[model samples]
Target chain A: MTKALWRRPEGMSVVFILLSGLILVFIFAPLLKTVTSSGPGTLWGTLLEQDVYTSILLTIYAAFIATLVGLFLGVPLAYILARRSFWGKGFLEGLIDIPIVIPHSAAGIALLFVFGQQFLFGRIFHGLGVDFVNTVAGVVIAMMFVSLPFLIDSAKDGFRGVDVRLEKVARTLGASAWQSFLRVSLPLAWRNIFSGSVMMWARGMSEFGAVLILAYHVPFMGHYPVADSILVADRFASFGLDSARPVTVLVILISLITFITLRTIACRGVRT
Target chain B: MIKIRALKVNLGDFWLEDINLDIEEGEYFIILGPTGAGKTVLLEALAGLYPISQGEIWSDGREISHLYPEKRGMGIVYQDQALFPHLSVKDNIAFGLKFMSYPREKVRERVDDMVGLLKISHLVERNPSTLSGGERQKVALARALATDPRVLLLDEPLSALDPETKEGLQGELRELHHRVKVTVIHVTHDFEEAVALGNRVAVLNEGQIVQVGTPDEVLRRPKSEFVAHFALSRNILSGRAGDGEDGYTMVDVGGIEIRAITELRDEVHLSLRPEDILISRQPLHSSARNSLSGVVADIIPRGAVIYVTVSLPLELTCLITRQSLEDLELRRGMKVWVTFKAGAVHVF
Candidate 1:
């Protein structure tokens, strides 16, 4: 009977009801468990630890880098996607969206293969004294790869939402193509770009698998920047992870703040 | 001077097959066709907006088909007043001059002159959206004329406005054309608009110029049935010319004799304006030779004029004032005498 009520002719189905219900479950179930523990100390102590602080800081730093990277590479490409039509446009769009569809661990493995020892980029970079294995560069690359699609897709949709007629009129009025974009299309799509920034930052913060695979040895820390490049394969994992533990904790803490900001921006983007 | 010869362009489904026309300096010519007859495409082609498939267009004795719109030295105003929404009225007027590499002093001078001539100086700083329909029309005119175009192409600029506004705006545009003495090629489907604004009218049907002449020539003697209908012409009588005195022609129009002043070589076709016919109850004996007895069959009240159709053996259309219908006690099926001069009887 409830299903029937929700399912009117050409109506929203019971799946929406179940989806909202599941969200309510995920949000409340955790708080309910914490409440039953009879202590807020566990949560508070976990929050104040040095490793936690360091991880949170590293997350913010790396996410900030990822967001900035997304901006530089994503914006012009997005404008191209929105504005012009050329051969292989659909194929190019699908290529941009590949990172989003692939599993995160698979994405990590893929990055590792490309930037690892004995690979093209890996050998070239190693020749320049740049090591990708167990480093912060890998973390940022992973974050950027996973989060770039969001920024590009959002920015492209933003530019597409603007009317082409307005631009044409501007062109007739003696404004060049670049001038028209800056004056007409850019201001209109700014809100979408802003939302894309938040999404990019949040996506960067949550990127774990790719970071773990490629550059996990920057000693993810709050103040002390550790650069351990020991060449033993087993010692490699044990030493670098110890240094990155505090940084990981800091990442988790900072991610909470960014997640809230991203949620607010995304909700507003959808609403308006 | 503006000249277009055998302009052939295949713009998708609405191809302009062969359009040929010319306008003398300071002449007002209107190209008229129904909607989707490629009127806009023709105008844009002249303005260098579209590539000409096969044609030669000359403006001021220079061929400009290959030039860009900005380099073509022509200005255009569309039906939907495409004022740059971002700019003020002053800036909009200054737009054309800014391009074409005008100096700052000349741009300002030209803008001022045009704004004053169009009498839109008060609206200079205001946005286009804030202006009324008539005001925007004036601004569009000002902007188009600012750079002093060799040929001004107005594409149904009055189509979207209300009747009163359209009439007033066209009057203003007509006055502007005269004052500026610019070669204007205006396009509209409105017959009266063509007549009111055109010194020479070209009636286009399906992208072909069926007739091009003075309004009187086109109206008095239409080249074809389409041109006749397009002008809302009321005179069409199918009859066979019979043997008469050498110069004086006699034709039988549905058993009624019509005496025409001109000689007829073949079957007689009479083309007369409805306004030329004078209706009466009694047949008057005068120099006017053609007088036919008929009954008023239909009375259609158009705006400020009445289309009174008299059912003689041949249908005769007469234009009379609304007051005449009541004053003459005219009604459907009322017997009436339709008298018109032989000179007014057109032969083609």
Candidate 2:
């Protein structure tokens, strides 16, 4: 049988192709079964319960606010980083990626230090009566800090996708700098920016540590707080570590749908 | 009228210095320069895309050095046919007429007229990228013309097209300028395109205006060495001065004498375009001032233009017409007398 397979030239390459295919199937089947069984309705009634619904809704809303800020703020920063030349630019780029590299528990403690009522920014927000230390706004700020670079870097790639010649031609035809940018540069770069926003929102929705540090009481009340949050000034922060946060489960579902939809529409990944 | 004085720019690899010239109202001015000589930069500066470090540009008696491109009242077409890809040919032609200062309703009328003038009416609704190279060039030219700009600057406009298309568009360009009477400054490298379309030619080399005059004067009489070679003169000879009437000098060619007029030096260089020289198998009595006997070295056929090189005793090359080919029974190694008028022998 081995001699017969080798003797036929066209039949030889087919055996190795099937072997690699069988290996991929061997690796993926059990992993897929584990995920499929643990999905929304299968494990517990937390999937459709009212308390679960509230946690899921709050996560989505907070993620949305952070993503909106990322869309307007991070995109322009990303585009500038991609297009312009300046001293200390590499340092600035490294700063944007800092949140991704830091430990999540450490990120939570960092968020509390600056956002506590004793801090200057916390006092300013306290005067506005919109509390950041224990509200949805605190949750969003935490998500924004961790997930912003994804939005900006992706948007920068989008803006760089447009040809500079098209803008030059527009200028010669009487289009001003801002006018040319709005007309020639923006429309061509829209899709990539949209995909970047989707990715940022998905990342933000899945954030738990920073939000737990700043606003643990929103999800847990006077329970055993996570050890790091207990060290912070915020009360009841110890409850988070063992509280079984429902928002994480809801965030996972929303992100799964979002990932599928965006991947289909974005078609190609943003090129750096 | 368009006038540029001492235009200078140092754009790294490409440089231009001391470029100076003026085209009268309704004149077709062509600037001929090789690639990377800052020709496009000069045109772009006039159109206000780049800052001219030192120079003054005037259009219609107004100094427009500091004005905006649209305010400068100039239209420029690039070699790439840089039409707006998103717009139809009709809209591309009408693109510039929508400034807050310009009339919107008047745009359509002008676009229609210019498109019809360029005979691109059928392509009015087509996207610019869909059009052929020739069609795109006409659209670009039409777009530039539609605004009724003070002057039109074409940067190597036809050099991008096929031969047949370039010649056809060349004729259309001459007619377009004649009918519109818009002062034009066309930049090109093709000598025939320059001669065919230029009311005046400015020969640019290494960033300087080497020579500028009417087609007959510049082609027949170039002032510099590079200009003589670039205009593709057949023979440039050194001769000791010989005296003639009307302050003309009879230049001493080796073993033969030819007469020409000059305001130049005693040791002068005489330029003769290949087409100006006539070839005959037998030496004959003629009105031409000087004739020399030589052997035919080679025959070169250049599309509608035939180059017959007659190897004179002093390695002289004479260009004759295709129609005169059979009349003179010209062939390689055939002994012939290359005859040219003394006045036609330009000394500079």
Candidate 3:
């Protein structure tokens, strides 16, 4: 009788539905609680604050720039990882995922050694009128350092999914290597790359440890250097939990909306 | 015309060595080999897809062994029909023409011409993912031909299709070649396909060219033991050869003496095709030089033909129709007579 019940579709579906319901509730309960805890007036008031709005905008802009840079730099490496087999390939692949495994603050310190004012790259950029210490560039570099693995790994899987024969066929059809990549490989891998970019952007937005160590006050509006996470941390430290909650709720609401919008666009793009 | 001189390719685990061939202009040449025989590798080498460790490829009096695949002016079609899935059928057909820097109107005209030629007009607007296997292959062919390549390379283009579809495409390929008059280098393992399509067939074994001849020459007069086995000559016997009566060479197989028409003396290998051997219940009065009476040792039925193995001190498998099997009431352990003409025996 137990075996028969196990084989029944309704019995199996009931267990699946119950387990899935637990995960959905677990994910939504905290968001729902926080969103409802704040009054509408307080949420609107937080949204209207210049410091809050500007810092949120700054965070979004920095993450967007970081994502674009990651796309530009990571895709070629991803394609190479996907297509070629050589000595130390495994070591190189593991190196790409190192940021994900290490602590974010540790990752920040590691980034600092290279991008700090005293380092070679930092000194070079400093000489070029671009400063990395306590600047927007530092924030973007920190975000990119922590979240680039998502983009590279996803893009590598995307390129791996595309058959190499397609590229070979394109070559035979009078397309140069670069042309084939643009016409065939890139387009075929667009969906994965787009999703990876979104993931990297989202991860960059929520980053606190790395951003705090690298750029505590990211310059914005050509005046102040205050990022969203840094501002929220400051509010909580000085004015306590109630002062921090409104801005936190505002940031969450904006991020959730943007992420959903991007995800929906990706899904529609796949369908059509 | 294309000529390959001492072409050698080293693919680490698999390699092609000392390969030489002269493919004439406007000929449907076949590179025939079994699986893992490096047929695709040789074709890829010709198309400049693989780096040749040593060799020269001359096409139309121009050396092209070092040219890039795109600059070689050759198109290749694979068995899987690697059409760009992101593009529509029309776009896939026009992909190469776009790279050639043709004007928009010329590209449109060329795409239309290709679609009309391949009879894929209705499928022009559809995505490649939605097409059938045969339809996808047709689109791949059209895409390759749109560039007006000097030589067309086909890597087992019909091997992936169902038998009926394969036959239909084979006929279309012949017709297409005739209409387009493009020099084709088609690779396949099927002897029947080679015979039906190839102007001349080059048999490859273990990365080396074993024999190059017309299909009949390769099939009837295989120069090596590998070719004899690979060509499906089921009855191969190693024996001593000596002069016999009526200008025939008598081959001593074990204790059985079989007469063959050959000048090869001493030890020799003879191949007799199963279809050439006739089976009967009694000895027939005919001009066939060799006849042996034996008991039917085994009876195996394949698709439409049955293999009847007779033991006359040596096992000889002969192919007969199902109707013949039923008419003769042949069964295992039944006595039977096997006979074939001396001319049917091929000695090497």
Residue B91 of model 2 has an lDDT of: 81
> Would you list the rank order by lDDT, best first?
3, 1, 2
For candidate 3, what's the TM-score of chain A, rounded to 2 decimals? 0.92
Which pairs, if any, clash in model 3?
A217-A225, A218-A225
C-alpha-based local distance difference test score of model 2 = 0.75
Provide DockQ values for all models, in the order shown: 0.19, 0.32, 0.79
Cα RMSD (Å) per model?
Answer: 7.3, 6.2, 2.8
1 or 2: which has the higher TM-score?
Answer: 2
Query: What TM-score would every model get versus the actual structure?
Result: 0.73, 0.78, 0.95
| Superposed Cα deviation of residue B215, candidate 2 (Å) | 2.3
- Tell me, by DockQ, which candidate is best: 3
lDDT for each residue of candidate 1 in A238-267, tens digit (9 for 90 to 100):
676444333333333455566787677655
Q: Over the stretch B1-348, how does candidate 2's per-residue lDDT look in tens digits?
A: 878888887776656888788889999998887877677887888888778889888888888888876577778888888887767889888776665355666777777788889999999999987999999999988877776778888999999999989889999898888899998889998887999999889887777788889887778778876788778886888887767765667777775677776655567787887777777877768887777888988888876667877777676666656777767777789888888887787787
Residue lDDT tens for model 3, A1-272: 35544555688899999999999999999899887789999999988888888889889989999999999999999999999999999999999999999999898888889888899998898899988778888889889998999999999999999999899899999999999999999999988898899989998888888888888876788756467877889999999999999988888898999999887776675654
- Please provide, for model 1 over B1-348, each residue's C-alpha lDDT reduced to its tens digit, 9 standing for 90 to 100: 888988998877767977888889999999988888888888888877667899899988999787766667677777777776667899888876765688899888988998889888788999998999888888888887877778888989999899999998888988888788888899899988988889999888887888899987887778776777777777787777766564667877777888877666567577778998988878877778788899998999998989899988568899999888778988788899998877787776
Please report, in order, the local distance difference test score of every candidate based on alpha carbons. Answer: 0.77, 0.75, 0.92
